[model samples]
Target: MTVRIVTDSTCDLPRELVERYGIIVVPLTVIFGEEALLDGVDIDAEQFYRRLAASKVLPRTSQPSVEQFAAAYRQAFQAGADAVLSIHISSKLSGTLNAARIAAAEVAAEAGRQIELLDSKNVSLGLGAVVLAAAERAVTGADLASVLAVATATIDAVHVVCVVDTLEYLQRGGRIGRARSMLGTLLNVKPLIHVEDGEVAPFDRVRTRARALERLAEFVREHRGASRLFVACAGNDGETEAFIERVRPDLPGTEIIRGHIGPIVGVYTGPNTLGVCPVMPV
Candidate 1:
């Protein structure tokens, strides 16, 4: 049986990987004033961040409509997928997974086939890692149950930690969960954060960006058993490479996947958001 994978744009998997794996990516909408742009479809990371810097107001993000997800599932089925395993960002963070759930039920009922949905419980490269693991399994002729098992195992073992330039974007975007405690405390201090229990939580507070980078590197170093590590930076490639270099010496054999914070995730992370997502063995 052919099992296809579906994910939202917030997964932040590179285009080549998505195409190579034949994964379907449903996009969320980002509204800038009266104009709306589809994440990674109408606008890319460079354009989104450029507009973000010059705009006075923050852009608002909306989850994909139910029909949009339904269309994607139908597309997958039409392309000869016997079953589809849909993975998405944390439901607590965005309604994307809920949208996927609604769509899955509708499509499954109509097609009379199985459509499995999973909440990755993480975002950006964290979710990307989960999707990649499942897709990799699916490509090997694994059934839906086997692919689902791999996704579940990756979710359990994956860890995501990030350092944002400021808490303003997260606060304004209403994504700041337990990380709210780090707000209203400092001006120049970089906030270190992690996704825990499908919600954002504060990890630490650092006085300088350099210290924050060191902490992020420490995060990767500590996860020595991870099979795959993804490093992401929002709207900045230089910093992503620098962080990888900082941690490369420590992790000699682990596969490091490069990820960019896409427009949908960028709306909350803002610019210069750097993080590490490690998928340890389950």
Candidate 2:
């Protein structure tokens, strides 16, 4: 059976990667005031971030509708595919998974075909890693069940750490209202956060960006066990590059992919967000 892969925009995989793997991306909506734009299609990351920086009100994102996923599934099956595996962002972070589930049900009812929806339980590169693995396996003639098993194992092995420049984004997103209140009272406090089991949680707090980077590296060193690494930076290329340079010597065998954090994540992380995710064996 021919297996197809689907994923949401938050995966942060490059356009080339998506096309190369024949992966279908369903975009989440980004709302600014009364206007709604598709994440990567109607609005590119550059434009999104530009608008985000100019907007007086904070930007918000909504999950793709069930119809969107249903449409994609129909197209895939009509094109001679036998099955589909949709890997999505954490359901705890967004309703995308729920939307995918509803879409899968609708497709099954209409076409009498089953679509498997898998939640990565992580975002950005963490999600990207799983999707990439599944896509590669699918191309190599792996069955849907085997591909999904690989994706699930990769999901469990992934870990993410992010450093936000300001607490305003997190506070506005309601991720750290109470913690921000307490942390903000102190000067020069930069908090490091991690996504664990689909939810964001605080990892540590440091006095400066330098110290925050140090702590981030230390955290990765302690938790990462012989895994490929990916680094994401938002509006801080120099700092991110420097951080990678400092840590490269330590992780000798790990392959690192670097990307700028897109606007969907920028909306919540604000500018100057630096993050790292490692894909280890489960």
Q: Which candidate number maximizes lDDT?
A: 1
lDDT agreement of model 2 with the native: 0.82
| lDDT, model 2, position 186 | 41
For model 2 the local lDDT of residue 109 reads: 80
lDDT of 2 at 146: 92
- Report, for every candidate in turn, its global Cα lDDT versus the true structure: 0.91, 0.82
Candidate 2 residue lDDT tens string, 1-282: 678999999888878888998898998888898899898888876677678778999988888998999888888888777789999988888888998999898897888776899989888878988998899888887788998899988987888888887768877876552345345454678888778888777777888988899998886687546567878887678898999898888887787788767767777878888999888865
lDDT tens digits, residue span 1-282, model 1: 899999999999989999999999999999999999999999998899999999999999999999999999999999999999999989999888888899999999999989999999998888999999999999999999999999999998888999899988999999999999988886889899999989999999989999998888888888987888998888778888877887887887799988788888888889989888988976
Model 2 alpha-carbon drift over 4 Å, by segment:
175-186, 223-225
What 10-residue stretch in candidate 2 is worst by lDDT?
177-186
Worst 10 residues of 1 by lDDT: 243-252
Residue 244 accuracy (lDDT) in model 2: 88
